[model samples]
Structures are given as structure tokens and as C-alpha cells.
Target: MRLTSGVFMFLLLVLSSVCVAETYNMETQFIAPIKLPINLVPLVNEHLDSPFERYGCAASLRQSLEASFVRLSPTAEPSILVKPAESCLCGVHTCSFWILRQCGATYCFAGHLHAHSIEINQATLLNDYYGLTGLPGGATSSEATHFLFDGKSYVEEKIEPKQIK
Candidate 1:
């Protein structure tokens, strides 16, 4: 049996919507000693910046941290979300969050963001990766930033204004 053109188009739209509707949410938990994959450790150390140079970079990072696992794509490996502990690692207003994803056999840095919270968009995508929204921290008038994966790393796409309710 052959399908009509209009039927084929409708099926295509349904499949595309199904793909877009798939999303993953990451839940962060505090981790002491900052346990991570051996291969990812170096990448994280190199990417993260610490204010305390005296303690050394790795030492400062290991001091206090939070982490979560997120799979941005269905067929891809899970990514790690590393956030600084509020007590030691956070800045005055916001803290940095690092995303590490598996690139081929080795894990690589996917993106870095500074915000109070990072949320994965449920129904938006770019380059086969999920979109993210970073909410600002503190009482400042700063706006949220939206990021989308460009096949390599997450880049800022737009500044989203705060919704007043």
C-alpha cells in the first residue's frame, strides 16, 4: 500500500514533534571531595576558574561542590553539571555551572554558565541538543540568558527578560 502525500506530511510533522517533546531534567545534589570521572577531572580543572590561587586550582574545586547528571540527547552519554558550593565556591551573586559531555570516547567540556539556577527547556531544541535557561541570582536587575548547543558547546542565544507576575 502507498501513503498519500498529505498523510506522509502529517506523519512527518508528528514524528518531528515527538522528537522535540523529549527532554531531560537534571537534579543537583551536594558532593564532597567532588567525585567525577577520571577523564573528566582534568577537563573540569582546566575549565573552572578559582579565586583562591593559594589553595591551588584542583584543591579549591574539591573543597565544596554540587553535581547532577543530564542526558541532553537520547543516544548520547549523560553529561555532568558541576556547581560551586554556596559557602566557598559561589561569588557574591551567582555561581558557575559546568557541563561535561562525552565526546567520542573521552569526555569534554560542553559549556560554562554563571547563574542561580539552570533549567532545561522541555520542548525546545537546537542542533539536536536541548536548550537551557539560566536564571539570574540575587536582587540585581539582571536578565536570564538562553543557551543552545551548537553541536559542540552551549552558547548564549538571547537574554530573556524576567516575567513579572
Candidate 2:
């Protein structure tokens, strides 16, 4: 069967979305130790150019990463509230607020400032979650799920951490 270009594109998009495995709304408690350079503490909420700016963020992507966090997680599900905390890693330069998976890895999603859209790269996401020392990243569908749903199950509750602004 010969497929039209338009139809092919649609199929590809759908498949790409479907190809992403299903992650759980699972939760785990963590005690993330801060490891940031000095002077960047106050500017943790600033939109730095790159997340690796040695001193502080002077970039433009403040909200995109916020949206991506929701797309990344099942529980927090990346909304304005679930977005990366301003000063991550204890007021680091520009590291994102990540899911910190149980498998020991992370998913860093940073969108361009002003433009509130996310860019989810499969290779990058996979590498980060499965790579060596993937700093506090996850949300890719590799999480374990609950077999049955109960009213009082963990999924029915919310985990609200006292965030440091």
C-alpha cells in the first residue's frame, strides 16, 4: 500500500508519541544534597542562557523547562507548580528541577525562554535516564506501575515538599 506524504507524517507523529513508554505516577522520597557554586544562590530563579553557566543563569528559557517537567512526570505532571524549582541543586547556576528517578538518573528539559514549548529528544532523554550519573532526571516510561488501583493507594495522594525559594 502506497502511503501519502501527509498521512505518513501524521502516522509518524502518532507513532512517536505512542512509542514513548508509559511511566508510573510513582513517588519516592529523596534528600537531594546541594552542590552548587557560590554566588548563584540568589539568582537560582533567573533565566540563564545555558543551564551550565558557571556563575548564574542569564538565559531566556524560564518557563519551557517548567512545561517539560509536566510532560516528563506522571504525578507532578509538569505544570507551573510542578515546574523546576528556581534554585535547583541548592541554588545552582542553572540546573533544572528534575524527577530524580529511582534508577539513578535524570531528565533535563529546558525550553527557550518566552516560547513555552518543549523539545523532547528520545536519544537525549534515554541517555540521561540511563547514562552514567544522570543528575536527577527521569520520567521517561521506564518506571514501575501499580498492578491494581485502590482508593487509598499512593497514586491517590499528593507529595508536597516544602520547597526553598
Candidate with the greatest lDDT versus the true structure: 1
Model 2: per-residue Cα lDDT over 17-65, one tens digit each: 8666433111211123233323323233453444443233334333222
Model 2: runs farther than 4 Å from truth? 3-10, 20-69, 75-165
Best by TM-score: 1
Alpha carbon lDDT at 152, candidate 1? 93
| Window of ten residues with lowest summed lDDT in model 2 | 147-156
Rate residue 91 of model 2 by lDDT. 24
Instruction: Give the Cα error of residue 46 in candidate 1, in Å.
Output: 1.4
lDDT of 1 by residue, 34-68 (tens): 46655565676777666452244345445455566
